[model samples]
Target: MTELNFPALGRQPTGCPPARGVLVCWLAADGSQVHVGDRLAEVRVADDRFGRRIGWVSALATGTLWHQVRAGEVLTAGAVVGLID
Candidate 1:
Protein backbone atom coordinates (compact mmCIF):
# COMPACT_ATOMS: atom_id res chain seq x y z
CA MET A 1 0.00 0.00 0.00
CA THR A 2 0.97 3.56 -0.65
CA GLU A 3 0.14 6.45 1.63
CA LEU A 4 -1.00 9.80 0.28
CA ASN A 5 -0.01 12.88 2.25
CA PHE A 6 -1.86 16.15 2.38
CA PRO A 7 -0.27 18.78 0.17
CA ALA A 8 1.99 21.26 1.82
CA LEU A 9 -0.47 23.98 0.97
CA GLY A 10 0.64 26.43 3.61
CA ARG A 11 4.29 25.54 3.49
CA GLN A 12 6.39 28.59 2.85
CA PRO A 13 9.99 29.04 1.81
CA THR A 14 10.59 29.45 5.52
CA GLY A 15 9.85 25.76 5.95
CA CYS A 16 6.65 26.16 7.85
CA PRO A 17 2.99 25.43 7.21
CA PRO A 18 1.38 28.52 8.69
CA ALA A 19 -2.21 27.78 7.89
CA ARG A 20 -4.45 24.75 8.10
CA GLY A 21 -6.63 23.68 5.21
CA VAL A 22 -9.75 21.75 4.41
CA LEU A 23 -10.31 18.88 2.04
CA VAL A 24 -12.59 20.51 -0.51
CA CYS A 25 -13.32 17.60 -2.79
CA TRP A 26 -12.08 14.37 -4.18
CA LEU A 27 -11.42 14.11 -7.88
CA ALA A 28 -11.61 10.35 -7.53
CA ALA A 29 -13.91 8.74 -5.04
CA ASP A 30 -13.15 5.94 -2.64
CA GLY A 31 -13.23 2.46 -4.26
CA SER A 32 -12.51 4.15 -7.61
CA GLN A 33 -9.71 3.05 -9.85
CA VAL A 34 -6.66 5.25 -10.27
CA HIS A 35 -3.28 5.22 -11.90
CA VAL A 36 0.02 6.54 -10.67
CA GLY A 37 -0.06 10.32 -10.28
CA ASP A 38 -3.84 10.54 -10.59
CA ARG A 39 -5.61 13.34 -8.78
CA LEU A 40 -7.31 11.90 -5.75
CA ALA A 41 -8.64 15.00 -4.05
CA GLU A 42 -8.59 18.80 -3.85
CA VAL A 43 -7.79 20.81 -0.75
CA ARG A 44 -9.09 24.34 -0.23
CA VAL A 45 -6.34 26.34 1.34
CA ALA A 46 -5.91 29.73 2.94
CA ASP A 47 -2.68 30.97 1.45
CA ASP A 48 -0.79 31.35 -1.82
CA ARG A 49 2.68 32.46 -0.86
CA PHE A 50 3.37 28.80 -0.34
CA GLY A 51 1.31 27.13 -3.02
CA ARG A 52 -2.04 27.19 -4.76
CA ARG A 53 -5.03 28.08 -2.63
CA ILE A 54 -6.45 24.81 -3.82
CA GLY A 55 -4.02 21.92 -3.43
CA TRP A 56 -4.33 18.45 -4.83
CA VAL A 57 -3.95 15.02 -3.28
CA SER A 58 -2.29 12.83 -5.87
CA ALA A 59 -2.04 9.09 -6.07
CA LEU A 60 1.49 7.74 -6.00
CA ALA A 61 0.70 4.20 -7.09
CA THR A 62 -1.80 2.58 -9.39
CA GLY A 63 -4.52 0.95 -7.36
CA THR A 64 -7.97 1.44 -5.90
CA LEU A 65 -8.56 4.62 -3.95
CA TRP A 66 -9.57 3.83 -0.43
CA HIS A 67 -10.02 5.42 3.02
CA GLN A 68 -9.99 8.94 1.67
CA VAL A 69 -10.73 11.77 4.04
CA ARG A 70 -14.10 13.40 3.53
CA ALA A 71 -14.64 16.88 2.15
CA GLY A 72 -14.75 19.72 4.66
CA GLU A 73 -12.29 17.91 6.87
CA VAL A 74 -9.64 20.10 8.44
CA LEU A 75 -6.10 18.97 7.72
CA THR A 76 -2.84 19.82 9.36
CA ALA A 77 0.74 19.27 8.34
CA GLY A 78 1.79 15.71 7.58
CA ALA A 79 -1.75 14.39 7.52
CA VAL A 80 -2.12 11.13 5.66
CA VAL A 81 -5.08 11.69 3.36
CA GLY A 82 -5.46 8.55 1.38
CA LEU A 83 -4.20 5.05 0.75
CA ILE A 84 -3.97 2.96 -2.41
CA ASP A 85 -3.86 -0.76 -2.77
Candidate 2:
Protein backbone atom coordinates (compact mmCIF):
# COMPACT_ATOMS: atom_id res chain seq x y z
CA MET A 1 0.00 0.00 0.00
CA THR A 2 1.05 3.53 -0.64
CA GLU A 3 0.25 6.59 1.44
CA LEU A 4 -0.97 9.92 0.11
CA ASN A 5 0.69 12.67 2.12
CA PHE A 6 -0.30 16.30 2.48
CA PRO A 7 2.53 18.35 1.01
CA ALA A 8 4.50 21.14 2.61
CA LEU A 9 3.28 23.83 0.28
CA GLY A 10 3.76 26.80 2.60
CA ARG A 11 7.48 26.42 3.19
CA GLN A 12 9.42 29.42 1.97
CA PRO A 13 13.09 30.20 1.36
CA THR A 14 12.78 33.23 3.67
CA GLY A 15 12.37 30.81 6.58
CA CYS A 16 8.63 31.20 7.05
CA PRO A 17 7.04 28.75 9.43
CA PRO A 18 5.24 25.66 8.25
CA ALA A 19 1.52 26.20 7.93
CA ARG A 20 -1.40 23.92 8.72
CA GLY A 21 -4.44 23.36 6.56
CA VAL A 22 -7.82 21.72 6.49
CA LEU A 23 -8.88 18.92 4.21
CA VAL A 24 -11.40 20.84 2.17
CA CYS A 25 -12.62 17.97 0.09
CA TRP A 26 -11.63 14.92 -1.86
CA LEU A 27 -11.97 15.18 -5.62
CA ALA A 28 -12.36 11.45 -6.08
CA ALA A 29 -14.63 9.31 -3.96
CA ASP A 30 -13.26 6.74 -1.60
CA GLY A 31 -12.41 3.44 -3.29
CA SER A 32 -12.11 5.21 -6.60
CA GLN A 33 -9.32 4.32 -8.94
CA VAL A 34 -6.63 6.97 -9.33
CA HIS A 35 -3.50 7.50 -11.36
CA VAL A 36 -0.33 9.40 -10.76
CA GLY A 37 -0.74 13.17 -11.22
CA ASP A 38 -4.47 12.96 -10.61
CA ARG A 39 -5.85 15.68 -8.33
CA LEU A 40 -7.01 13.85 -5.24
CA ALA A 41 -8.07 16.56 -2.83
CA GLU A 42 -8.42 20.30 -2.22
CA VAL A 43 -6.94 21.91 0.86
CA ARG A 44 -7.48 25.29 2.50
CA VAL A 45 -4.08 26.31 3.79
CA ALA A 46 -3.61 29.05 6.39
CA ASP A 47 -0.17 30.54 6.01
CA ASP A 48 0.89 33.39 8.28
CA ARG A 49 2.26 35.47 5.46
CA PHE A 50 0.07 34.37 2.60
CA GLY A 51 -3.16 34.18 4.58
CA ARG A 52 -5.56 31.60 3.12
CA ARG A 53 -5.06 29.82 -0.15
CA ILE A 54 -6.21 26.76 -1.99
CA GLY A 55 -3.85 23.91 -2.66
CA TRP A 56 -4.26 20.62 -4.42
CA VAL A 57 -3.10 17.23 -3.34
CA SER A 58 -2.22 14.84 -6.12
CA ALA A 59 -2.01 11.11 -6.24
CA LEU A 60 1.50 9.74 -5.97
CA ALA A 61 0.62 6.27 -7.21
CA THR A 62 -2.01 4.58 -9.32
CA GLY A 63 -4.38 2.47 -7.27
CA THR A 64 -7.66 2.41 -5.37
CA LEU A 65 -7.90 5.34 -3.00
CA TRP A 66 -8.91 5.04 0.64
CA HIS A 67 -9.40 8.21 2.65
CA GLN A 68 -8.00 8.23 6.16
CA VAL A 69 -9.02 11.77 7.02
CA ARG A 70 -12.39 13.44 6.63
CA ALA A 71 -13.32 16.85 5.34
CA GLY A 72 -12.53 19.72 7.74
CA GLU A 73 -9.79 17.77 9.44
CA VAL A 74 -6.70 19.81 10.32
CA LEU A 75 -3.62 18.64 8.49
CA THR A 76 0.09 19.28 8.60
CA ALA A 77 2.77 18.58 6.06
CA GLY A 78 3.54 14.87 5.64
CA ALA A 79 0.21 13.87 7.17
CA VAL A 80 -1.15 10.69 5.66
CA VAL A 81 -4.50 11.61 4.16
CA GLY A 82 -5.20 8.37 2.42
CA LEU A 83 -3.89 5.02 1.30
CA ILE A 84 -3.58 3.46 -2.14
CA ASP A 85 -3.85 -0.24 -2.45
Write one digit per residue (lDDT tens) for candidate 2, span 1-85: 9998887775655665556789999999999999999999998887777888898889889999999999999988789999999
**Each candidate's lDDT (Cα)?**
0.79, 0.88
In candidate 1, what are the lDDT values of residues 6-58, reduced to their tens digit?
77664456766456788888889788999997878888777755454877888
Error of 2 at 44 (Å): 1.4
Task: Candidate 2: list runs displaced more than 4 Å.
Answer: 12-17
**Residue pairs with backbone atoms closer than 3 Å in model 2 (clashes):** none
Candidate 2 at 57: error in angstroms?
1.1
lDDT of 1 at 31: 89
